[model samples]
Target: MLIDTHVHLNVQAFDEDRHEVIQRARENGISHMINVGFNRETIPSSIALAEQYDFIYSTVGWHPTDAKDMTPDDLEWIESLCRHEKVVAIGEIGLDYYWDTSPKDVQARVFREQIRLARKLGMPIVIHNRDAHHDVVQILREEKAAEVGGVMHCYSGSWETAKMCLDMNFYISFGGPVTFKNAKQPKEVLEKVPLDRLLIETDAPYLAPHPYRGKRNESSYVRLVAETAAQIKGISLEELAGITSRNAISIFGIK
Candidate 1:
């Protein structure tokens, strides 16, 4: 069985055919999906989806792009939801220098706060890093995120930077980008990541894999991702699926 370690089924992109999309994922051997809820809009929707589906789980936190709007009350709200049986981790939270939506300092502070929150709750985190690898690593180091190691979702950094995250116990999760023809860096990084510390995701409604690139993505397309990862790892699709599923289970503490 395969596990989509990161996804966003709670978002509006799937509103029309949400159930159909989920059914297709199950039909395609997707066993579990970790749906991330960042910011005010998605958290409640994410929790609702998890409650409605046995195989679905949720992660809650503030995205770096929406860092400026994350109030103290919002943090408290996220903390409260972490107690839910289906709430697995504390994120999709990190730096997003590419967007430049929130100030760099605000993003860093928010990232550090969520990391501290994860540490306090003894929960893993799901990170979303975009064009801020240096500060992302620095803040994670300063915040001691290694204690409750998590995932670098849709990882797109140099092998050197990946090594740093690996040292901190973070799994390197590859998504649709790794399947693209020109994605040399992600492919090379995927090849070098230790099997036990490797993961796969769809990040559905975004970053669709090859043959489906620039289109709306869904969990069912994770098979394409697995195929590419298996080739890169020189393993069978079944073996890669089992390995990545197990890694997802281990990190999320999903029973």
Candidate 2:
């Protein structure tokens, strides 16, 4: 079975037919989905989904875009939710220089703090990086994030940089971009990454794969990503699913 390691079922995009969306994912052979919450607002929704479905899991943290808005009380609340039975990781957290929603300094500070929190709680992290690779990896190293390894969601970097992340005990995950006709880097990176360290996601209601590109993404489309990864790796679809599923279990500590 395929496991979508990163998705956002908590957002408004799926509020109309969230159940249908999840049902479709299961119908498409997706066995599990991690609904990631990157801000205080979405955290409750993420936890709610996890509470509702046995196969759904939750993650809580502030996105770098919202980093400046986080407070000590909010961090404490996130730590509190860590005790929830289905909260599997602290993430969707990291740096996003493209949006510059938060100042670089603030982004770095919050990202580092979350990494420390994950280490303290002995939980893996779910990273979100874009255009800030240098500082993101540097902070990860400084924070000793490898002590509680995590996944680099929608990884956007060269194989060399990916190797650095792998050395730091991180798995490189790919999403819809790999299916784009002109996506050269991700395809190359997919081929270079070792099977054990590879993972796939849809980032649902966001980066849907081709044919569904630019449309509202859903978890079921992870099969498209799986197809792309399998084709790139020259493996059968079932083989890719089994490998990625095991990798997800290893990182998320899912049962």
Candidate 3:
């Protein structure tokens, strides 16, 4: 079975057919999906989705874009969620300089706080870095996030940078970008990832892979990602699914 390590089924983009989308993913062999909560608006729905679907899990944290509005109360609330049986990790948190919505300092502070929270809770994290790879990796090291480890969700970096992240106790996760025709970075980095450290995700409702690029994405599309990763690694699709699913299980602590 395949595991979609990242998704956004809680977003309004799937409000009308969330159940249908989930059903289709199951039909297509997606065994588990970690629906991510990026901001205040999405967290409740993300938790609800995990409660509603047995195969669904949740990751809660502040997105870097939402860093400007973060408050101590939000951190406490997120911490409270660690007790939830379905709460797998602390994140979708990190740096996102491409948007520039929040000051870099604010983003780093919030990211480090969540990293500490995850480490305290003895939970792994899910990271999001876009055009801020250097700062993200540095902060992870400075904050000692290696204590809990984590996945670099939808990783967009060079093999060298990925090596740095991996060395700093992070798994390199690839998503739709790996299937894009012009995604030379991910394509090249995929081979560099240790087979056991590699993970796959669809990041549904965003970054849909080829043939469905620009279209709303869903968990079922993870098959395309696994297929592409298999080709890049010269392994069978089943092998890719087994390896990535195992990686996801290891990170998320799925039983």
Candidate 4:
């Protein structure tokens, strides 16, 4: 069985055939999927999807791009959702300097607040680091994020940055990008990440892997990622699947 450690099936991209897409994932051997909801609109939809599917789980958090829009009420809402059995973590939260939709300071503060919330609730986080790797690692360090740990969602940073995250007790997650031929850094990093701390994902409707690159992505495509990861790790596909699925389950506290 395979588990998609991170996905965005809750978003509008799958509104036309979300169930069909999920079924495809199941048929493709995806035993479970973690649907990440980063903001107000997606969070409830994510939880609803989780409640409907026994194999699906949800994570609640605010995206850095929308940092300017988040208020105290939103933070409270995320905290309340943490009590939901289907909500496994607080995340998809972190610095996104690429978009810069929100000011740097605002993003940093909001990121810190959610990290503190995750720490308080004793839940792992799902980080989204973009061009702000330095600031993201710095803030994570200052906030002592190691106490709770997390997954660096769709990690695109260098091995140096990834090593820092690993040191902070975070798992390094790879997605469709790792399947690309020119994705040298991610492949190299994936090779170096310990099997127990390594995870694979599709980041559906976003980073579609090669052969499906530039096309809309779905969870079913995670098999391609697993195959590439297995090849990179020099293990059988089944072994890689088992290893990554266990890593996802362990980090997310999946029951």
Give TM-scores for every candidate, taking all chains together and pairing residue i with residue i. Answer: 0.99, 0.99, 0.98, 0.99
Clashing residue pairs in candidate 4 are none
State which candidate has the highest lDDT: 1
| Model 4 ranges with Cα > 4 A deviation | none
Q: What overall lDDT goes with each candidate model?
A: 0.95, 0.93, 0.92, 0.94
Taking the tens digit of each residue's C-alpha lDDT, what string does model 2 give over 1-255?
A: 999999999899988998999999999999999999889799999999899999999999999999999998989999999999999999989999899678999888899888989999999999999898888889999999999999999987999889989999999999999999999999999999999999999998998889898999999999999999999999999999999999999889898
TM-score of 1: 0.99
Residues 1-255 of candidate 4: C-alpha lDDT, one tens digit per residue: 899989989888899999999999999999999999998899999999999999999999999999999999999999999999999999899999898589999999999999999999999999999999999999999999999999999999999999999999999999999999999999999999999999999999999999999999999999999999999999999999999999988998888
Q: Which stretches of candidate 3 lie over 4 Å from their true place?
A: none
What lDDT is reached at residue 187 by model 4? 95
Model 2: lowest-lDDT 10 consecutive positions: 100-109
From the highest lDDT down, the ranking of the candidates is 1, 4, 2, 3
Clash pairs of candidate 2? none
lDDT, candidate 1, equals 0.95
Number of clashing residue pairs, candidate 4 = 0
The 10-residue segment of model 4 with minimum total lDDT is: 92-101
Runs in model 1 lying further than 4 Å from the true structure: none
